[model samples]
Target chain A: MPSTAGAALPERSRDLRAFAGPVVEWAIWIAVLAWVFWQTQRFDREIAQYAFGAAGWPRALCIAAALGATGQLIYRIAEIRRGRAAVPEAAGPEIAAPESAAPEGQKPGLWQRAKHLPIFIFPLIYLYLVPSVGFYVATPFFILGLLLILEVRTLRALLGVTCVVYGLVLLLFTRFFYVALPVGRIESFYDINNAIIGIARYGM
Target chain B: MEQFLDGTFNLFGDGQAVLIFALGLIGGMLFGAIPGVNMLTLGAVLLPFTITMQPEHAVMLFSVIYCAGVFGGAITAILFNIPGAPENAPTCFDGYPMTMQGRSGKAIGAAVSCSAIGGVASAVLMMSATGLIASWAVRAFGPQEVFALIFFGLAVSASIGAENLWKGWLSVFAGLIIATVGTDPVGGIPRFNEGSFFGLEFSSYYLSAGIHFIPMILGFFAVSEVLTQAMHISKGTRERPKAGLDFPTIAEFLSVRWTMLRSIVIGFFAGILPGIGATLAAFLGYSQAHRWSKKRANFGKGELEGVVASETANNAATGAAMIPLLALGLPGGALTAMIMGIFQIHGMEPGPLIFVNSGDLVWITFAAMFWANLFIILLGWLQTKTVVQILRVPFRWLAPGILLLAVIGAYALRNLFIDVWVMFLAGIVGYLLRRSGYSAAGVVLGLILGKLGESAFSKSMQLMDYNFFGFFERPISALLITLGIAAIIVSIINEIRGADVQKALMD
Candidate 1:
């Protein structure tokens, strides 16, 4: 696809994307104002105690803001009216930086390549398990898992760092700050004193 | 005179007071160094711990945190690309550019010095003009006037949007709409609560939508910024350019001194005006400095003078904000408002009676605030030298760290993880808005002013039986409205002129 530039850019047209931005903004502003006015009017007519009598500074200010917003939309509309909205500008042809920079068609995907579902599911799992397993139990595994997924070298390094971090948090929140940690539902097996004593007995 | 001396003596006399100031200084610096951990959180978190202490000591610590936290935010803002506080957001535009240019040390120095100067200047003005400013605040600002002041804040923010005024207003409008969530302030009517829609019946009282700030600040300033940096990450991070915390030369100092002075004055005056916060103070100072600068074009591109002006104005706002806080028990910004809560919690009512009844305590708080400013300078300066290296942390790593904190912080705000999700969603929206060239300052300011504007406007109408001009009967209200209109007109003229200049340059 040849790049468009300068004269090649769209000279004039009612581009939907360009027009949609301002239209949406205006609709939002109008809807808000109408809603407020209707609410205030209704309240004024209802319970006498609810009546504010007339439009005071807040109403006037809302009207003024709505006008300002409308004016902005008008200005943007004028820009589109003139052929000068953000018509896609052209640039020179693509040049790959060295071939080794990133393997062709192998960029690190933000979420997933074709819905790699676990990337989304993992965070959800962590979020659910966090309070239940407690910060101490959940944090180390979370850190370790994230590190492994990110392809951080060396499992030792990952575990070491996670343990250090987990220990530090446990000390700060539970010991120093005295923030109570949730000891999961299996209270019969979990001993809170043992965990605290173990940590105090042997520093990370 | 006797009271002032006694207050000063009492400050130095108490050992606990020293400890309180020290804790405030350290807490302020720590919080200010971390983006999203603003003074409000630090103060509020410490509030419980200080509850059992003497009122004077607690107040001293609170004021110290308030003042130091305001200045301490510039630390991360200068060293890293992130602003620690929402008010310091503007500082990062130039402050970070300076750091990248190997002037990080001087940037921090300028920020620290100007912060102290601004803070002290505002404190002095607050002490001298507290009574007069209070009367002016109450006498002049009816609903009409307060609304105008909010308008002025938006205008001030909008003018700084530079070439993207449309996008700026868009964000402001977005903020305005979001602010309308919860309950109607005047009539107590529930509007837009979406009850019975998803089997979600929120408490009406809670629905009067008190959005958490720290999470929002984190979302807007930290999360979005980190994501943006993450997208652009290339290779290993560069070593932070070394400029060992050194003050500017005398000539350099002389050049920016006037900017600092002017910004302090502007900041103080804006602070004295109730309902305005550091954002407007900062915006006004930056624009005023640009208007005064010999090389105005160098402003957004890391000018030392620009940093001076912004830091001074924002920091100076601390004490100026206190005037209303002390005199009328009305909070200026979120943090100071929390301080007002503290005053109330401590059984010290802040009003005309506070001046008469607790005059000595007022002086003591001011003194503590002053010392806090000084301590921020010394401690912040030393920390700036050592802290530059922390900026080398990868955005990839830092983002996760911050995200972790954000989750915890939001949950801690009211012990609800739902707030954490709200924060994440807000961050996404905030990031999109930023990428689209909208100002977050407008959003924050709108959020702050929106509720106040609504309630005040409603009350004013009720007081006057809906006669719109009833507010103008007061002389002060009329003057503020006139000035507000004039500011808008001037801003428009300047913007038009700027556009014309740009067109000419293009031609």
Candidate 2:
């Protein structure tokens, strides 16, 4: 049984990828640790000695992270070898879990397992597009796409939300707050950004 | 006494001052409740407008906003896990859980009342004795003490949501690493931020400001939350929050009287520090609440005391933040820094001399804050009844809006696109970390305190000839470090003696 801390328990895996989630997370962390340790060598060698503290704080933290992760890994393996999770009823809150563990029912296909990918990917695309296409032009499309991705099927619901969200942002952020939104480099996006800015700033 | 009276008269006597108060109250609460936008945004937008207004009104307006804004974030933190500002992050721990359990009204009610109590109490303390207290308080905290305090904060934060102590510390270590991303505090050397590591070349000057915790908070709390809910929605396991305003009874407020008092003291002291403000205060309050709470296990599980503790301490910090700004000419946080700008715009400096030169302005602003905190209770009640209605909106409609708000909030921090990138990236990382049973709260705590800790640690080491034990030489630092060490030991003991340890090996 999972504790109340909301640690994503590695679901009783239905596939190899789902089962290997914990191992993969460890690998990524170890890679990060290795990179950080390597960077410690680049500190201004003259003034950056640990005694004087330049690369020292990060180095110390990286070392601690490695030890903590390695210890957990060893302990987890021991628990598995013992044939059950030793969830130590009072581990005191934080525990270990594999990422994005699928539901523990019958085997789901890749699409079912990866349903949450769009949430991540959509934001990345939105971020990537915002700078190039300008914020005002790209936001409506982004909201519409997100609405559809979230299973919002009604056309009225999609457009209404898209328009309301976009309009509210334009009114409050651009008009009232006077924040500088990203105007794109392309000629058309530039014009769109300017037009929106003009309309938002002065009205009509 | 005469200056205080005159300031009170000045604020209430002028009809324009009354209008300014209304605008600040309404504007502050509105901006404060919005997910991505904070009251600082309101302050920044109003900065130029302040130049055209009377100095006292301008100064009073920011003060009121500070009080109302800190309180406003609590509403969102309760109704949604999205904290409107960094200070309200801790409120999300229990407040959102309470909401999930369909007790948002009770959580909001406690938050509103405690926030008012914290704000008004701190304001009263701040008003009559600014000169004596600020002069004494600032002198007491040196680098050694500051480092010890941050050390204590981080140590206690390690076990916040972690059942496994190792996972909690790892989360904190990860945050410390992230905090070291931009620049080394001692020598200003850029750390893991950019440049070549093992023949890898990267250049991003924006790393100079480092990863602001605001983006990290928004990312972890808001963006990751939406993703989690989206997954749940897909799974058909989503729970809609039932709405009902259950204002805590008089007994409920009295129940946490100790928490309220302790938080006020904690918030006041924390606020007087130049860099440490409401965020630290809120976390400290929450941490201490968990420590002393009779219902400690219920803390992250939607405990009312959790909301009260966090909201009170943060709002308490709003008043205490003014202490340094008014008394020492030191801005405690971003909003206060802007208030300092307002002070300068009026051709006045904030130190002890300001008490003599512009005592009326200082006192009038104080008077307005006093009223603003009380007014927030009324405003908060109205907002609660209305904003709680957000729970009625389909989570699908609310979800995308939260993400959009997260984007705007992150970018608004420094007007940098890198912040947006950082926020999105944090969302992904946060999702993974949360899934792994890592405490995002621990990471945030470490991030919030890491820079302060590193800088203060370095300075303390220099002052004490790099001796680790030198911290114990100073009484205050010694006391703090001891308390921190004690907390770690208790956590270790708990882990060792935990209930199901033998079940794993024997089964």
Candidate 3:
């Protein structure tokens, strides 16, 4: 199938992606504020000697942050209501670089905008598995998975990176720093960890 | 003076001492530049092996490593945006930006010279009045005064690169709140620890010890940065950042001399405090540089002064930290504590008696550090010449390595998987915040400064019977806090008068 840019999209639909970006950012800001407010509210009441107790400092911070975010959001919305592109005036350079470089004449849907999803998700999976599958076992696959997702298909690049990164991890963490690193609970994974440790510590 | 001359002679004339210094320089730079491993790790690994060595050689080795390690971190911070240690975090703010701007060589050069300046100056101060300064620092800078310094640092930090004052403050507040997650300092109450589902007994148990800095720093600076780069690749917007050896000229060094000196003073003094050390010194140096700069607008956008301020102060702190350890028997930080362990292994205690009983040893250690700092200029430039080659590698290859390093960096802090999880989570948060016109640096500043300030705040409160106004009774504390408040007010006024406060935030 053609990429989003390869298939020409309707101008209105194309603009919708641009329109949705700020809307999503706004919603995220609001959600985060709510969560922070709720989290601070959950702390137990204050101690007498403490300056407003365990809850005071965080609660004070929560109020201050909420006020700032709320104020900024309100200003942004008001500026937009007056038919001004105020966000573009000072909107994030971090967001700008990618947004400006996006393929033209395309309708960038949520998926189009979120091409970084795999990069973000892969780490979570790798992190969750490390404790169970062992560091030495899981790392190569983790690296391979990232390389594949990022479209680095060259055999030389893939093998070179995998070996160098994995070797460095093994050498620096285990052999040099002497970190125990996680061995894992499953018998197979345990053996995998042991085999590597034995090879590293005592030789093959 | 005789001891000093003998110490200098020992380092230069003795083959063993010369060999040890060379070993320390290489080992420190190697370990300190690695993602998760640092000089402290190197020191810990070497501690058991140091027993057979002579006492003077053993102690001298660690001092050289300490000086070199602090500067080693700056190289990684400037080139890769991967601060090898927490103290190098501020360097990343400006240094990495310069790398992207193809000024990596200049940034590295600034880091090298200032680090040398800081290290040498601090060594001089440490040798000249170790006992006197340690005693004066202890008496003058109590909890209240320390709180004032942190308050001032945080206040200036919010305005460092932030265009919108409120956005910066919001970022700071969020950081302060996030820092309160593990536990309340005074009461040991688990503030944000997850409770059981449906009344089943559950919590992380150890969270009362609080969030670790390693995970948070890795998440914010490294992991999130990878995501930004990945986004560009996936969107077909990939562009290789500029990297070269356009090192700074002598004129550039002269330009930042004031910042260099000021930061060294801050870093040296900050290092003398028991719990607070190089990390605070670095952040404070960066913020103070921003506060005093004629071109404040250039900071965090790749200012040479920013790199000079942070690297110099952090290196300076290494020598200053030994002051308390040698003079008052107090460990200024973890690395110093390890050096104390070295002293104990050698059947020597590091108090006023150490100087009286082993005057030659103290001078030798001091001379070793002074010389070690001088060598950093050459070694650091060599590193800059070589390390910039990595920038030629594609982001696809570098990102995975960085992430893997991030995982280990986080977990190794306490060998807790929770830290790794936190690192990923913070990365997600950091990426989102940066895209939405928020200041991640402000958040970081708040987290570190707030953590240090909270304990001081608690102590000051108790010292003054919980009366908030009583803190201002102390002249130093009063002056610092007043300055902080004035800065906040001035920034707010600037915003009201239609200043471009939103640009830095949005940028």
Residue-level lDDT tens digits of model 3 in B346-431: 88888878888988889999999998999998998898889888888888998888888888877877889888998889889878
Which sequence of candidate numbers ranks them by TM-score, best first?
2, 3, 1
Candidate ordering by DockQ (highest first): 3, 2, 1
What TM-score does model 1 achieve against the real structure? 0.79
lDDT of 3 at B411: 80
Candidate 1 wrongly placed segments (more than 4 Å): A1-70, A80-138, A141-174, A178-204, B1-6, B49-52, B159-163, B195-208, B234-247, B273-275, B290-296, B328-360, B471-473, B489-507
Tens-digit lDDT track for model 3 on A1-204? 455655556655755654566467556666776665666656767776776787777766776776776666665554445554345422332233333444557666887757667888998998889899888888899999999888899999999999999887888777767887888878999998989988876677
Docking class of 3: acceptable
DockQ of each: 0.15, 0.33, 0.35
Summarize candidate 2's per-residue lDDT along B369-438 as a digit string, tens digits: 9889999889888887888988999989988788888888888778899999988788777776765567
Which residue pairs show collisions in model 1?
A4-A90, B182-B207
Model 3 vs. true fold: TM: 0.90
Question: Where's the lowest-lDDT run of ten residues in candidate 2 chain B?
Answer: B498-507
> Which segments of model 3 are wrong by more than 4 Å?
A1-51, A70-85, A89-107, B161-163, B196-202, B500-507
Q: Model 2: which residue pairs collide?
A: A91-B163, A92-B162, A92-B163, A93-B162, A93-B163, A94-B162, A94-B163, A94-B164
Q: lDDT tens string, model 1, B1-507?
A: 465567667887888777777888888878777654567667766778666888778777878887888777787777655567766766775676677667888888888888888888787777778889878866765667766666666665653532355555556665665566656676555544443324544344454455655566666656555444433333222233444456666788798778888898878877776667676788778767876788665665568887898899998888888887788878877777777777878777888888788877888888777767776778867877788766554333444455555555566666655565556667666655554455665666566666777776666667777777876676766666666677667755644443523222322
Model number with the top lDDT: 2
Error of 2 at B78 (Å): 0.8
